[model samples]
Target: MQKIIFYVVVLLCLVVTKIQAQETFEQRAKVIAENIENITREEKKILKDKVDVINTQLENKSITREEADKMKIEAATFHAKRIEERVAFEESRLNTLIKEKVDGKIQEASADSVTSKRVSIIEVRYRKGNGNGKRKEVIEKRTTSQLVLAGGVNNLVTGGAVANSKFRYWGSHFYEFGLTFNTRIMKNNNLLHAKYGMSLVYNNLRAVDNQYFVKNNDQTELVTSSTWLSESRLRNIQLIFPAHLEFDFTPKKVNEKGETRFRTHRSGRIGIGGYIGANLQTRQFLEYQRDGFEVEEKQKSNFNTNGFVYGLSAYVGYRSTSLYLKYDLNPLFKNNSADQNNISLGLRFDLN
Candidate 1:
C-alpha cells in the first residue's frame, strides 16, 4: 500500500510537470532538430576517422583479409548504434515537446475540448501522470518475457561425466538422448511458476569384453590366434519423469536501452523420479569347434539375438536433466547359469 501510494504521488508530480512544461510544437521541434544536428555532426566526425582507418588497414597488409573485414563490420555496427541513439534522443525530445504543446492547447481551449481530448487523445491522466509510466511498465514486462525465452535454452543442453561405478559405472558405449520442454506456469517479481518437461527417447546400451584372445595367443606360434572372440550385447528402452524443486537466485530486468540481460541465478534443484521400462538383450551367438572332421554349421541371430529383459532405475541430474547409471539385477539368458547383467550409464532429459 505504501509503495502504491508513493507511485501514485510520483505520477501526479509528472503530470503537473508535463502540464507546466507545455510549449509550442514548433518551438520544441526546432530544439529537437538542433540537438539532432549536433549529435549527427559529432558522430559523423568520429565515423569519418573510423572509416579512414578501416580503408587504410584494408589496403595495408598489416591485418589479414578476415581481420580487416571483421573490423569493418564492427565499425558498421557501431555506426548503426550511434544512429539509433541519436534517433531515440530526438524522438524523446519531440514527444515531450509535442505533449506539452498539445496539452497547453487543450488547457487554453474551451473546457469542453479538454474533456473531449481526455476521452480520446488522452485516455488517462493523473496530476503528475502522462501515461509514460504505464507504457514503460508494459514494455518492461514484454522485455522480461523475451529474455526468459531467449535464455531458456541454457537449461536443455546439459551433460555430465560418468564419475563412479557401483552397481553402476561410467565409460561404456552407454548413451541417452531426449527432447525437453518447459512452460512457465507462473512468475512474479519475487517468484516464477512453471511446469515444463520432456517426453520419449531413443535409449541405447552396448559393450563387449573378451579374454579368449589373450589365452589363445599364449599357445599359438607364428600364426597368432585366440580361443576366438566371444561377444555380448545389452540394449534397452527407458523413460523417466522428473519433478523439481528449484530455487532461483539472481534476477534481471531490461535496461532503459531496451536490451534483455541476465545475471547468474545459481539455483539448486532436488528432483525425484523413476524409470519404468525394460531392455531387450542378446545373450550370445553360439558356435562350435572340433579336432576331427568338421560338421555342419549354424548362423547367428541378426537384428536381435537374446530375448532376456528386465527393469532397473536410479536418480541423478539437476532440474532439467540428470546423468544416470542403471544396472539389471536379472539374468540375460534362460537356464544358462552364466552370471550376466546390464550396466548402463545414460542421461535423463527432464520432462516435469
Candidate 2:
C-alpha cells in the first residue's frame, strides 16, 4: 500500500510538470505565430505598394510593362526575404537565451546583436559569347591619283658645227617644246616623290653661215683658193635625253619660263650625254676661189657634209627650266680643218 501511494504521488507530479511545459510551449508557439503573421502582413503590404507604383510607371511607353512588372516582383521578393531572415534570427536568439539560462558559461545573444557575416556576389555579362552581332566596315587611308598638262614653247635649239668654230654659222634660231607625264610614287606626312618625270623636250634646229675654202693638190703642183660661195640653208632635229634628281619646293611639277630645251641658262645641272644626228645636209655658203690662173668671185657649190653624228651636252640653270647651253664634246669633221664648239641656249627637261 505504501509503495503504491509513493508511485501515484510521483505520477501526479510528472503529469503536472508535463502540463505546465505544454502550456509554456503553446504560449511560445502562439507568440512566434503572431510574429510570423505580422511579417507576412508587412510583406503583402509592401508587394501591394510596389505593384501599384510599378503599374503607374508602366503606363509610360519608355519602359515595357513586362519589364516594370519584373522590377516590382524583385523588390517585393527582396523585402520579404529580409523579413524572413529577421524572423529566423529572432527564433535562434530565443533558443540561445533559453540555453544560456541553464549554463552561465554560454553567452546570450542580445536583441540588438545581428549576424555579422556578409555575402556579396559579382556577375559578368557574356553578351559576346552568345553570338557577335555585326561586321565592322573599314576605310582606306591612301588614295590613287595622276596629273597631266602641256608646257611652254622653246627657241634656240641646235647642236653641231654651226656652233663650232671651224664651220662657224648662226642664222636661224631653233625652237623646242616639252611633254611630261608624272605621278606620285611615294607620299608621307613630310614629303612626296615621283619615280619618273620632271620635264620633257622636243627640239628642232636651223642656221646659216658663209663658207670660204682653200685646197692644194701637192702632187699635181696646183694651188686653188675658193671665193665667197653662199648656200641655201641648214636644218636639223635632236632628241634630247634628259634625267634629273631634284629637290622641289612644291610637291608638284613646274613649267619653263623661257628658251628651248637646248638654251644655255645662268644656273642649272651640268652632266654629260652622247647623241647622233644629221648635219650639213645640203649646206651652202659664201666663198672666194682662184681657178688655175685667175683669182675671181664665183658660186662654189657642193656644200654637203655627212657622217655619223656624235656629241655631248652640258647643263646650267637651277630653277625649273635649264638655260639650254650645250657644247658638242665630240666633233663630226674628222680632219676637215675645223675643230670647233657648237653652243646654244635652251630649256632642260627631265625624261625620267
lDDT of 1 by residue, 143-212 (tens): 1110000000000001232222111122124333222222223333323323223222222222223211
| Cα-lDDT of candidate 1 | 0.34
For model 2, residues 1-352, the per-residue Cα lDDT tens digits are 1222222223222211011111232223224334544555565577778888878778866679789977876876676566647655645544443333334543422212211210111111112332476554333222211111111222221243233332223333333222322222344321222212211122222222333333332111112223333332233333333332222333222225431111111123334344444342222232334465433333332222233444454444442334444444543233444443334454443311
- After superposition, candidate 2 runs with Cα above 4 Å error: 1-172, 177-233, 244-310, 314-321, 334-338, 347-352
Residues forming the 10-long window of minimal summed lDDT in candidate 2? 117-126
Query: Against the true structure, what is each candidate's TM-score?
Result: 0.29, 0.29
For residue 298, model 1's alpha carbon misses the true position, in angstroms, by: 14
| lDDT, each prediction | 0.34, 0.34
Q: Determine which window of 10 residues in candidate 1 has minimal summed lDDT.
A: 146-155
C-alpha displacement of 9 in model 1, angstroms? 59
